[model samples]
Target: MKRILSISLLLLFNLGQSRAQSEKKIAFGPYIQQMGTKDAAVCWSTLVGSMTVTDPSGKTDTIREYKQHAIYFQGLKPDTKYSYDVLNDGSNEGKGTLTTFPDKIVPFNFVVIGDTRTRNNVHKKIIEQVTKRDPRFIVNSGDLVSNGWSMKNWESFFEINHDFMKNTPYYPVLGNHEKDSPYYYNFFDLPNNERYYYFTVGDALFIVLDSEGHRTSIPAYTTEGNEDAYWEQSGIEYLKKEKEWLEQVLKLNHQAGFVFIFQHQTLYSVKKSRVEESKKVRAFWGDIFSRYGVQVFLNGHDHHYHHAYDKGVHFITSAGGGAPLYDIDAPQPETVNYKKIEHFINVEVKLDEAVLHVIDIDGNEFDTIKVKRRDVK
Candidate 1:
């Protein structure tokens, strides 16, 4: 009897272990990306061999291949709330909430922050503050991870960003620190091959560019696989295509109430390493923006907060997303405000105007700027 009982207990224990192992989920997101007026994309990684997404109205979408799933929730109404879930083998795995973009110009709020390369504890704090605001979505200017090639870095980011990333749609630009890693590209479902793209939310047009692609030729920043050869192979082509695309996009959408461009490098930062690159990129793209009447250009890389306005354009360096802070060396006349601290920018867009607020990690607003939407006719 003792021998039989011991054998039965061993079998039961093994069965439980197998069940637990089967329950473990795959790493990373089920976050919102590529949000639109009537549809949105949800992406996640699962090794159970397939992914299934179920919406509030009981509509289900499924994908049968790949370890990662990019499921689109289509036929949704404009500016409506949606509750969604991800299931693996028909078992609930993850849940998130989202709101579709409004079809017309209306009052909306969005948060912009970046340079979250390290210091994950502080990054979590900033995310906590961001969650409190409950903005419609969040835009990251870049440097999301210290080493984008490292899976550990991405795991760390996803672990800490669970609160916000899981629920709020994230639109991120590519930072130099990202190194154009496959991990970076695989993590988000972006338009235009995830290099650079533009999207309109309400009446505001947000343009994301590949600054590192365009500015790789500037001075001492060349690497063996990342320099002229890289440019000749692909960077140059990408830059040219993006420039032409930008001109056309701006021309067609010139009547947009607001045009905001975001990237990884700053056009007017006092930081030492970025000086030459900044000048080069400014020369390359500044006139294009001015000609198109781009209202604001947002970026990260300075690891601080800065605001500058030049020739009818606003230049904002908001790299305060948990990276080590850098100070201003020499403030320019166009610099309206500067701060060395962890912070994020909140922009509230209205039909004819917009409001920008610079808020620190402690949840204090230090500055506010009001921009009137330009008449494009």
Candidate 2:
């Protein structure tokens, strides 16, 4: 009887494990982190059809199904409250809440960080800090890799903090690590033709550029494997297209309040492995932003923080995401021309002002800067 009972218990335990796996949901995020998205933005991994939007009064609004197309939620009101859920069939996957912003100049807030590869738990901790401050959205300056863009790292990244991602609409810039696989293309539904794309939030038109592709497309680097030919062997061809796209976006949103360009790799850096961005590439984009009045450029590559400016554009380099650190690459000898901080930046855009505050993983204020785009009444 003892032998029979022991065998039965072992069988029951195995069955329980099996059931857990079948129902095993990796719950990541369920918070409202994005603003200025009228109704649609890329859904990436979120199940659009399964999402349910609810009001504060508990009135639920069902999301219409999206069949195979990239997920973009529509029919939402401006600067309004809505609770949501990313469901799997009739079952639930995760939940979140969000507020939409108006088309014209509206006040908003956002956070910025980058190169969060190999530091999965760090991302989680950072999210915890960010929630306390209650900003609008988050920007990951890309390089979310663990060794050359492996699928494992990508999966590990989401596994570690799907909760934060689900809750917040992360505006990710393309980094060297994202090249690990075609998973970014498959997993993330971004704007524009390629991963290097653009979107507008409030008064800002966010452009995500690809530094790896830009650098690697040089004749010295891309004499082979020209298979990914969106442009010629020269990455310059691609940047030109991006420049043209920017011109169009600018012309289209001529009355836009601000333009912030984000990508991996800093315009200036102290990391030995990476060189200062080729002036040619910088000049092309820099001139356009200057010509069009983009106020800032945000980037990450040398897993550290450095902020500098050329002409009028503020370039913020924030690449420390609980990963190992790097030394500063100051451009000037007398003046460093860069503010270094190993923390995330919170940008608050009110009806009257836009404030940039840098905070540590513990939510400590490291630095602050406020830019006035227009006159306040």
Candidate 3:
């Protein structure tokens, strides 16, 4: 009897060990995505395993492998809240809430943040403040991670944003720091061609443009003098195609009550170093924004807050999410206001106009811009 009892205990120990090994732990997300009037998606990742490698210098690196999972829902009610559990195994880790976008014209509010790369503490604080506002959704005008190719960086990003993103849908623009990684595409479920797309909330149109065309390496044989030319020509075709698409989208949505455009690069930079580049960008998309009545053109790249007005379009650089701040040394002719501080914008869309309250990390409102709704025929 004693021997049998000992054997039973050993078997139970092994069973418990197996169960523990088999249990799944969420590594990222279980966050809301692809939010629309009647459909939504919840995505999550789980650590599957890890591998260690030793370099020539005897430096060891351990890479964690993760498996991504998503559940999509359809035929849901518009502008309604719903709770979801991806795991449904009595674990809160897999649980989250989501609200669908409204199907009809109505008032709403959303948040815009940019360059939330590095400075996890600051990012967390910004998120805390943004959460208090209870925005319907959030848009990051690129640079979501310092190095989009680094899984570790992404891990930190998702961890910091877990609580807020679990309910609010996130839309991201592509920044240079993203390095055109496949990881960015893997994590996001965007509209249209993904790179450049447009979405609508009632009569308000939100367009995201991919200013950083396809990232490619220069040819080894290219001479130093021709390097810049090669770089320019590499993505010229893609940019042209994207421009055509943008024009078509703008033309089709000309009657939108509110039109907001977002990109990763600025068209009006107050940073001395980036002024020329900004001019080049502005020249490339000459007068298109004014012609299409884009009320606000929001971008990130320069780590500061600068607003400019030209021909009915408001150009804003709100890249104050964490990354080191840069000085506003070159104020352009159209500059309205400039500040070198970390901040985010809360846009409240009402019947007559949309009010943008530019609030800093300390919860101080520094500037406000109101764009009247476009009059429809």
Judging by TM-score against the true structure, name the best candidate. Answer: 3
Show the colliding residue pairs in model 3: none
Error of 3 at 188 (Å): 0.9
- The sequence of per-residue lDDT tens digits that candidate 1 reaches over residues 159-256 is 78876876789998999889878878878889765888899988899999887774344346666666645554556566778889889989989889
Q: Please, what is the whole-model Cα lDDT of each candidate in the order they appear?
A: 0.80, 0.61, 0.88
TM-score list, all predictions: 0.84, 0.75, 0.93
Q: In candidate 2, residue 251 scores what lDDT? A: 71
Candidate 2 local lDDT, 1-377, one digit each (tens) = 00111000000111122344436332223323323545644333322224577999999965432122233456766656555544433444544455565555767787888877866777678767776766556778887665544545655676665656655666677777666356666555556665577777776667777666654433555445664452434466666677677688767866656667787867756554454343434655667766777777788877776666666777777887766677655453222334444578888876655688878777787667666674211
Residues 262-338, model 3: lDDT tens digits: 99999998989989989898998999999888899999999999999999999999999999889889999999999
Which stretches of model 2 miss by more than 4 angstroms?
A: 1-18, 25-37, 41-72, 88-92, 147-149, 214-234, 272-280, 284-286, 333-341, 374-377
Error of 2 at 312 (Å): 1.2
Residue 132 miss distance in model 2 (angstroms): 1.8
Q: Which residues of candidate 3, in runs, are more than 4 Å off?
A: 1-24
lDDT of 3 at 207: 95
The candidate with the higher lDDT, 1 or 2, is: 1
